[model samples]
Target: MRQGRDNGFQAPLWRAIAVYRIAALTYATILVVRNVAHYQRPVLAWPVVAVMLAWTVFTTYAYANPVRRRPPLLIADLLLTAAALAASVPVVGRQALEEGKPTLAVAWHVAPVLAWAVAGGRRAGITGALLMGATDLIVRAHRDQAALTGSVLMLLAAIAVGYLVRIAEVAQERLQRAIELEAATRERERLARDIHDSVLQVLALVKRRGAGLDGEAGELARLAGEQEAKLRSLVAARSVPADGDDGTDLMTLLSRQESPNVTISGPAEPVRLPPGTAREIAAAVAAALDNVERHCDPGTRVYILVEDAPDEVVVTVRDDGCGIETDRLSQAQAQGRLGVAQSIRGRIEDLGGTVAIVSAPGQGTEVEMTVTRLT
Candidate 1:
């Protein structure tokens, strides 16, 4: 992927490279014209400089579009630049090069190294630098400080540009994340305001009015009160602090499902899983709990168990409720109720995991999800 922001420092860097190429081309052309008299093949030097000028113009437009900046184009740039440098050997003549006269390419060869650095990072930049530098040195046919200076500078430029590219990518990623977080925060606040004005008020009223009644009336009141508290907690809950790029602690999320009627058990230490995987598992568990809440009697017991292993993680949500016939599930799917299939089964399967649901009439439902971790 192109490493830069929508409005970032990296975009300007490419333009800078193009500008450098143009300036270097001009410098090289001037040197070739001025020193033509000293050249062994004076007529040949102009053609080499002309090719460099054409390439400079080509790359200026080609690299401006990000879609054209791929490995194939980068490879072509590096090889063609090396070829231009090699052309110096015959055009400038070996003896003149030995006498310290500048090659036909001169500063123009470094442009490809900068392009590699911007596109592929430090290692790729270094590779390009070494190849071009070696070509320059071999074409010059000498090994002195004067011959090595350009190569060393190219290496340094590659390293610097590659490092800066990495930093720019990180900065852009963080900036995008910050913008998303701000938008999410605003939406959450608006939703909270609406819930407070409507749902919470209605729930509180039901709890108060129906509390003194008997049988299902009181039970309904208790459920409403419980839902009100859960909704408040849901809206007010803070996100768990991320544990670097490794993953999120799965136990922390599962523990959040704990309630007066629900029990969660897991390893004492943190059970770390990839963030997306952990959240999907937690959501599946939540879906199981929801099924228990909607279908089972009030105060039905739900137990969540998490098992962490080297190659896999398993989460089981078992509820001691009035279980249904297995055929009922198929019937429900056919009738368009897909909470169990989509939320619980589909989520685990999408992550390359397995979901085994075991339930029978008069027996409780047990949802066992096993996700194998990619080492």
Candidate 2:
């Protein structure tokens, strides 16, 4: 980020730099204009002219360049500050010698410290203080009545401002990071819901119908179902990267809180399922029962069982109803009807598991899905 030269300790670093550059130029222009009557006095005019030119060039560079150019910019800042301080010493010296008392040189000391705070960052501000202090000492060293106490107090204040400027820079960076994270999380959730409702749902239906049929037609439905489940899982696990990506996870991004009707049965022990296994298993079971609820009897009794073992976790859902004929499902698939083929079988296989269907005429359908956890 780039900002102009207004180096207020509280504002963002870039804006401070931009403000500093403009203020420095304005100060230089005003100094020259106000001292127009002193043009003939080369002793005073020449140094002011030199300092004005140096401050303009340095402030311009600091404002234009980013943090990548900080090294070179920092070096130039130090040089410009040194020149400004050197110019101030002679001007201050002439004042003390003529007036016999030290007077405030606003352009010489105060403006330079403000410029350091804006364009040069913390180190630059400290450098300005040291130079300002040195210039005060130079004029005071010659006299027994130099105000050492006031000069030291002003130098310490400049150092304190430098540390405050650093704190402000850190705070700005953190705020930007937090905003980016919030936006990404919201986008991920939206994608998940869309995929789950439309794409994954179609795939699940295809798998279920395929399982209902027998022979070659049933096999085809099974293949289509497996593909859909994998796609859904992939969509649920994705994340957006720093470079800005529209990424999403299938389960989390797609599935909503709209609870599915599921019946689970198994041992009391927690099943050690694979990464995507448990969620997909639950989805497949829910999809199956949905089909049973819609196609079979409204009061159909469905049973779910979870078997936990050392190698695998098996989930079985059984429903009592008339079994499906193999031939009718093929004709349905040809017409692109995927209700049973994609939804159930495809989901189970995607989790590195198997879907077992057992049915014969009046002997109701039973689906046994087994997922093996690799750890």
Weakest ten-residue segment in model 1 by summed lDDT? 1-10
Which regions of candidate 2 deviate over 4 angstroms? 1-84, 87-100, 103-107, 110-120, 142-165, 213-375
lDDT of 1 by residue, 1-375 (tens): 343223356668889999999999999889987999998889988777778888889999988877788888788888888888888778788899999999888899999999988888888889899999999999989899987888999999999999988888788877877787778878888999999999999999999999999999998999898888778767775444334356888887876677668888888878888889889888988898999989999889899999999999999989889997869988999999999899999999999999998999879899999999998
Best by TM-score: 1
- Tell how far residue 128 is off in model 1, in angstroms: 1.3
Cα RMSD (Å) between model 2 and the true structure? 13.7
CA lDDT, every model vs. true structure: 0.86, 0.57
Compared with the true structure, what per-residue lDDT tens digits does model 2 show for residues 1-375?
A: 123433243345445554655565567556555654433343674566566666656555544444433445545555555555455445545544344333223333444554464455556666666776666566444434445655666566666666666677667666666677778778767887898898788878888877889988887776667567556655654353322222222223222211223334555433434435556666787787776767675345677776777787777778886666556556867899765567777887776778877776667788888877666
lDDT of 1 at 335: 98
Query: Worst ten-residue run, lDDT, model 2?
Result: 242-251
